[model samples]
Target: MTSPQPTPAPGRVGSAIGWSYVVTAGRIGSSVIVTFLLAKLLGPSEFGLLAMATVFILFAQTLIQQGLVAAIVQRDKLTAEHLDAAFVVLVLAGLGVGLLTAAVSPLWALINRAPDLTEVCLALSPLVLVQGLSIVPEAILRRELQFRSIAIRTLLASVLSGVVGLALALGGAGIWALVGQQLVNAVAGLVVLWLVCPWRPSRRPKLGAIRELWAFSAHAANAGLGSLISSKADILFTGIFFGPVATGIYRLAARLPDMLVDVTVRSIQQVSLSSLSRLQQDRARFAAHLVQLQHLGAVAGLPVLGVLAATARPLVEFLGPQWAGTEIPLQLLCVFGAVNVFGVLLGPALQAIGQPGKLAAILWSRGLLGVATLAAVGALITSDDPVGQATAVAVAGIAIQLTVNAASIWVTVHRVARASIGRFLAPTGPAVLAALAASLVPFATDRLGVDELGPLARLLVVGAAAGLVAAAVLWSTDRPLRQLVTPRLMRLRRTRAATGTPAGAHSVEASATRSTEK
Candidate 1:
């Protein structure tokens, strides 16, 4: 298979951004629908059981995938032999993980005291295999920045999974429905990746061809494992100490923030990973690009997370009374989400700069800190107040984790590119301030009885209003962010009229030209 090229044009980037918006919307919508259906079909107990199983499966998958697909996107040259070797590695790892999951299914079932989980685990095992096969092809597509195709594939997978899951639930399949949905989604995703992506695995494997790749992969795996442990330790503790009902409630509270994080951080990571990889040879240029990305993420991320944190109570109530206890946890988790924007952007930087070992070390440090925090919190809080304990654990862990992550990324950037912390944080400060200011309006509105509005109306009014206000505030306070994001918005009417393209597209064209020339 041939290596995928960079995005064809600035218009292509815009198009990809548009498609990403659509794909994100689709994923969020599907998640809300699925969650609602499952909540109604199965009570908190069963939902929590499924959530526990899923957390394990997802963490395991992340470990096995080893961030190599990300490595491939960051690497400049992708030979046929490299592709072949990566595919071989993925296949082997996938098969091994699948078999291991299958073998452990009975033991997990016994430990959890849920016989039904044995079937769920066994049925979901194929997902690892399917995902392993699809990783390289999906990476190739991402490298090409052909997110429209990816969006289409994702939509199909979501629909198939939703339909299959709902059907199974209607048929009284219990937790099997959730497991079936995930497996089916994996299969669909693999099929779509195969069909849309041009890469095909070769008949022969080239082990030696991927030595450097394996080194990167190993570091990435270690980092990913650390990240996984850090992120999931709270949930694991909840499952162990508080039982499935509490775990399920906590999961529900976390759902919205998690969805937003996935949509924003994950999408940006895809773009940054590919773009930064191309500029890796130039330390100065790469650092500039990294800062630009960090600023963009802040501009986009802070306002959204701020609003969610501010309105968590209303949001929980609107979702359902069953979700009422999730309000505080959601609010607390949003802090992590805000800090995570910085840490997540650094991942691509590390990959691009060929410093996966440093990334691994940072992740391990954060993970160890997170584990210690969780353990300490669990011991301190009584079992009668599991939610409070979980929240405390999450907040404490995230605080330490973010501190370590920020320091590590700062050190790496300064050492590698002679960058300073002030340069990195300056652009984001104004936007963060703007978002904070906008959040006050919503808090006041909630205090003044506007929150009594219907759920849908409240969401629309508060969300839309806060978004507009925050955008305006940022535009006024942060000239660079405004120029970087929507330069056309600041341009004179005459200039906009002179351009045939929308002022926005015109600005994008100009920016792209400048970028290319540089």
Candidate 2:
């Protein structure tokens, strides 16, 4: 028998961030390749069928976690009683959800009017139990900052799932390819978690012990439900308003462009919440650090949006003729995605400050705004046209989310950092210029014969050149970029004297007090 590798002890937050990046990047990269392969092997209609099925699977998976994962991570001290109680509650919830989903599979399909959803739900229901069993253990790993093991296990599952999905699709499995891959991936990951994590829950759950966690868990779960709405509502609206093929196209467009932003934001948020929770007692450090990460997230993420928006044409072609009609939503969502990138830090930052309730409210409000906007826009804008309707859904959903997130961040900063919105956003100003410069290059090059080149070749060359130019522009214009990008030897010339900064503070409760005014 193979000896189980002992999980690494929690390391520095930066190291955890690094490993999380690997895990996230690996998953997304494999996803991209898998998507490409699947798109080639299957038609848009087939993809649409899978998309409909996925709505339930993702919804159930999200419901299973119920954000108790956050409760575990944010709690100051965890005991065996806490673990045992959480495990019991989570497992029971998982089993119940899985069984309920399986029982209702046909009804769900009939309700959605998608006959294929029944088998999809039944196939995917078991994953809920596996996912539920894994959540507490995974949450514990995250709390311990054990991302190395997490990354390894995730990479293993992702790669293996990708291979299986590809082989099955190539073998003409159609939608079953997707269903099988998801189930295999979940089971593989759960098995790995069990092998690596040494913690074993006691036999019984103490209801009283869980009461202390309920306060936080309740808010977390509510926020998660809201997030569930926000994240999946667009798909629901699309499937309802436009049908499966259009939904599939919209899903495709949303996936590739948003992948980078999603990965970067999730990784940064993971690090942000973990680090900020540690610094919660020292308000100044927490404020300053969050400000830094907010800036970092924007600068790192915004350029990709700009690039995607500029290059949508080539990408649409690269996906082949089957994806021809997806360009509009692809383009519109990229723009909204750019707008949304600025507020990535707001939600997690608020949660870090013990305001999950407020965040939950904002998320739900965001969801309502999204659903309302999507439904309203779908009915009103380009109502006669399917693609136009889909584009409107993408735009409305993301725009409401962006608006709500910005307002939430503004409020959080005022309530917690006692700073003006402009001050909090000040570091982000240069990023806009850098992204604009990067974007203009490709657009300009397209006019200068870049478009005549073969599609893939043109994409690579223009993309690489644009990135280099953007780096150069930022390096010349921004001191932070210069310092951050410079080699260790070259960094000697950059002085930290100018970079040294003071801090500010405000409290979440008892009104904003000015103790350490800037």
Highest TM-score among the candidates is held by which one?
2
The predictions' CA RMSDs to the true structure, in order, are: 3.6, 7.7
* Model 2 lDDT, full chain set: 0.74
Q: Give Cα-based local distance difference scores for all models.
A: 0.73, 0.74
Candidate 1 global TM-score? 0.88
Whose lDDT is greatest here? Answer: 2
Which segments of candidate 2 are over 4 A away from where they belong? 1-11, 381-385, 487-518
CA error at residue 67 for candidate 2, angstroms? 2.2
394-430: candidate 1 lDDT, tens digit per residue? 6775678678867776766677656887798888887
Q: What tens-digit string does per-residue lDDT give for candidate 2 at 1-96?
A: 012223222236556666667778888888888988888777666677677777877788778777788878777777778788888877898999
